[model samples]
Target: MRLTGPVLLVASLTLGLGCSAAQAAESGSSSPTPSTTVTIPPDTTDSGGLSPEEVQRQVARAEILRQQILATSDDMAAAMTKVEEAAKKANAALQAYSEASTEGRDAREKAKTQADIADALQERLDQARSELREWAVSAYTQGGPLAEQLGYLDALSKEASEASNPLQDLNYLTDNRIRSVDDIRQVAVAQKLASMNAEAELGKAEAAEAKAKKAKLKAQGFVQQQQSALDELRTAHAEHVTEAGPLAGLLLGTGDADAIAASERLTDALAASNVSIKDLRLTPCTDASGVFPNGQIPPSNLCPMVGSSDEFLVPDAAAAFNAMSKAYAKDSGQLLCVTDGYRSYAEQVAVKAARGPWAATPGTSEHGLGRAVDLCGGVQDYSAPAHLWLVQNAALFGWFHPDWAAQGGRLPEPWHWEYAG
Candidate 1:
């Protein structure tokens, strides 16, 4: 019924989950889920006053609890991924909409310009036709040019009264009539060309207008898509908060006091969880109403550490440690082994029970808050190559050996390191 070392640590991380499952079992439910709303016990610390016996009972089911936590973590991670994808799509959609809208506006403007040109051309055509009509009317009212010339010639011949030759006068009048007709014919030709140009321009204008309308519709569709994506992102995030919060609370202690005690733990957990520090960021509670005893922060608040199933830390520290570990691995052909991170008050108690004086008092340890980690592999030995390498390179990643863990310090532990940031 008892597990040791990593198994025990892993199990301890899921104590809250195990308790919830136990409740569900009692209620005859085949599946159990953590409560979104955690009722703060009268004593937020002291592990909700769980007796040593009850704690052991939960520890007996550590593997099961660990699996449950992992499953929930995976689900939350998927939801988070969806949210990210949705956000990206939404951004792209918005960009498309902006471009489409701009194009639509330009198209409409061009259409208007073309239409105006067509209108101007039509006006010119109308004026040309009116001038031609006026000339015809004047000719008709004057008894027509040919008829008047004939009449004048007849009168001259009949009178026999000498003037210039009649044929010559008739010829001169004919020449004047031909010149006037030529002028009118030229105007009509020019008007016809203008009308053709105007009609083409109008066609172009209509096409442009149609294009503008299509672009506007497309832009609207994209905008709507972007809005829908935003809504999905919000929903996904809310679900993440609902499901992961309690799990994080169980992994690390919650409430203001535990938060203060485990401030580093919280930072590291947030980092590892991949939650934005600003969004799910935790500040130590100032009032009694908000204090959660050890292992009280929501799972949503803590991040899973790299290369660690049960371990969690703040984002920056987790990133740095992973980087450091990768660098170490590149040099040594093996990853830096991690044994523990982000201890809850309950886990702190268990560790104390198991390791006695070696463990910090419950609720007082950095492991409870998530900023510290205990290493394995050769790093545990001061003279080990891993330890020497860390001494030379770990500080580059904001991780360093504390004075207490130095060779000449109060309790030299080569494997114990804390995140500076």
Candidate 2:
């Protein structure tokens, strides 16, 4: 011991200084000093030769790197979720826009259909109005006072064209307006033209009836005008003939003057009888003037008694026939028909011989008495109304139908009536 205190003090200083150096190194303030005798152990597998503070620093750095990795993973997840949400939103928007476009197209198609219907309706209305106008013009030309009425019809047709439908508009017109205007116009120009033709036919029928009535009236007037002239001629002839019959009887010596006067009286009585003679004539038997003073001969050879020097009816029996006709006419509005008034005795004899048993002998025939007359009604047929009237009424005229039943070998003669005179 070199002096124990000095030695102890130095050792203590050295140790303290060594410890101070180590602390400085640990604190990273300075490097460690190399020592030959002091052995530092080689770094082993179990322990990295690091201080406690360094280890704690290394652990903190590793923790920080792991936290960085976790943060990156969280960020990636968030980004993927955002991309998926955005894609769903875009698809939804696309679907909505497509539906809206389809609805718009459908609405446009419906509008086009409505427009087409409106166009067709308008065309029909125009055609109907044009036809109506043509009809109105035709009615005006047919010469009625309906020209102004036709103008009104044209106005109505214009109004109808303005309407949405013309056929429906036709119902709005009144009955008289339709008949006098629209109906008349359509018929006037129709294919058959039946309405106008019917009116013309009616007019013709009325004119024909008027003409027939006028002709009938003219015929009746002519018949009435001639009645008086016929009556005057008949009266004059009867007076002149009455004086000749008896003078002829005296000249022929068939009777005395008194006898002739008596016969004359009988003739006068017969003339005065209730009879109507439509016509009568007398002629002398001959042209010998002095043979009978009052006798007047007819100036013709047609009389059968013209050569006889005696007075006679022109056919020798005309006086009795005249008297008979007068009686019949006085009792009825009808006149007798002298279908066969007189016959010469020779002619009668010739007829009898020609007809054999069917004809009467000359003097025996009732026709020689000149009391029979035939009759005819105004018409041609011999039907019941005329025949029954004659049968029921002829007896009041002092006339009888000798052939009432067609008996006694005589033909039925509906017109034959004999005066009892």
Candidate 3:
């Protein structure tokens, strides 16, 4: 039925609805409505078209991606911190190496300086040893105690070289070695003094030897000179004795035995008259020319007492008297008179009794030896010009007057001399 009117239509729709329901019953209730139109707007939330469970799963996945990004940033920050720490460590090592290098260089320089000082000390020691050796050798050559002492010093030097401690070595050199050096100096000074003294002694010895030699030579020369003088005197004496032989016999009355006998018999008359006579009396009365006699009484014969005969004096006495007389005459035009010559032993006894012991005994008298003479001036005054002339020139005839105190029994007689020859 075609439902046209409203009531009619209602009745038809009911019928149709019943048929559609039978047909909808035949299809599944889960099928999509084809005649119904369902419309939806665009989704504003992040779930888009998903269900609640799907929306929840998408939120969880997004949360996981955010956690991964955070973890990566943390790793990068850790790497940066590690790089800063490494840089700091490298800087600290460089600073430590620089300090170590500087200290090592200083140590090396110090060691070098100490070595140089040690070397200098060694050289000084060596030089000192050499000098000591030389000095020791010289002392040994000289031969004495100094040589022995120097040997000891050399040994000490060698011992000092082997010492380990530097300070100990220095102490040995200063106190012991230097002291030894001082000792050597003192010895040298002492030796010099001794040498000077020895030289002085040697000089004195040489001078003494020279002086002794000179004295010996002078004494020898004097002896030779005296020998010549003695020879000349002896020759002159011999010549005088030979020339007076004849005169001596005439004076002694040897040529007239009768006259001599008569004279002997007139002894008392001669003695009473105090006639002066030599031991050998002259025959008759005579002067130099034997032609005159003086009447005046003669003095006592002192010559006979002395034991000397005029004959003993003979020519020597005559020659000497004549020579003196000639010199006196030539110089002063005056004559020298001879008053006495020699005497006998009896005469000396008489003189001794009269003049005391100062006179010589008979034989000991110089007059007995015929070596004496007594002279007189022809005029008065024994100090006359002729007497003075005789005194000045008598020594030329080898004559000398004894001193006044030595004249036996006579007073000082300036005109007397003994022939020294």
Q: Write the per-residue lDDT of candidate 2 for residues 198-255, one digit (tens) a residue.
A: 4444444445445444433443333233333334434543533343232222211212
| Candidate 1 RMSD computed on C-alpha atoms after optimal superposition onto the true structure | 27.2
What's the TM for model 1?
0.34
The C-alpha RMSD of each candidate to the native structure, in angstroms, is 27.2, 77.9, 87.1
Residue runs of model 2 more than 4 Å from their true location after superposition: 1-334, 353-355, 375-387, 403-410
Candidate 3 off by > 4 Å: 1-314, 378-383, 404-411
Q: What lDDT would each prediction earn against the true structure? A: 0.56, 0.40, 0.42
Candidate number achieving the greatest lDDT relative to the actual structure: 1
How would the candidate models be sorted by lDDT, starting from the highest? 1, 3, 2
Q: By summed lDDT, which 10 consecutive residues of candidate 3 come out lowest?
A: 273-282
State the weakest 10-residue window (summed lDDT) of model 1: 276-285
Error of 2 at 412 (Å): 2.6
CA shift at 200, candidate 3, in angstroms?
41
**On residues 1-421, what C-alpha lDDT tens digit does candidate 1 reach at each position?**
2222432343355555545644553566455476634343444234433444543443333334434444545665665555444433433333343334334544545556655655665676577667657657766887555666576767677746655666776687668767666765665566566556656655655665565455445434543443444355455445444434433344332223332233233223323433221111223222222223445645555666656778876555666677777777767877888998778778888999999888898876767656789999989999999987776555445466766778898988888987644
Cα lDDT over the full model 2: 0.40
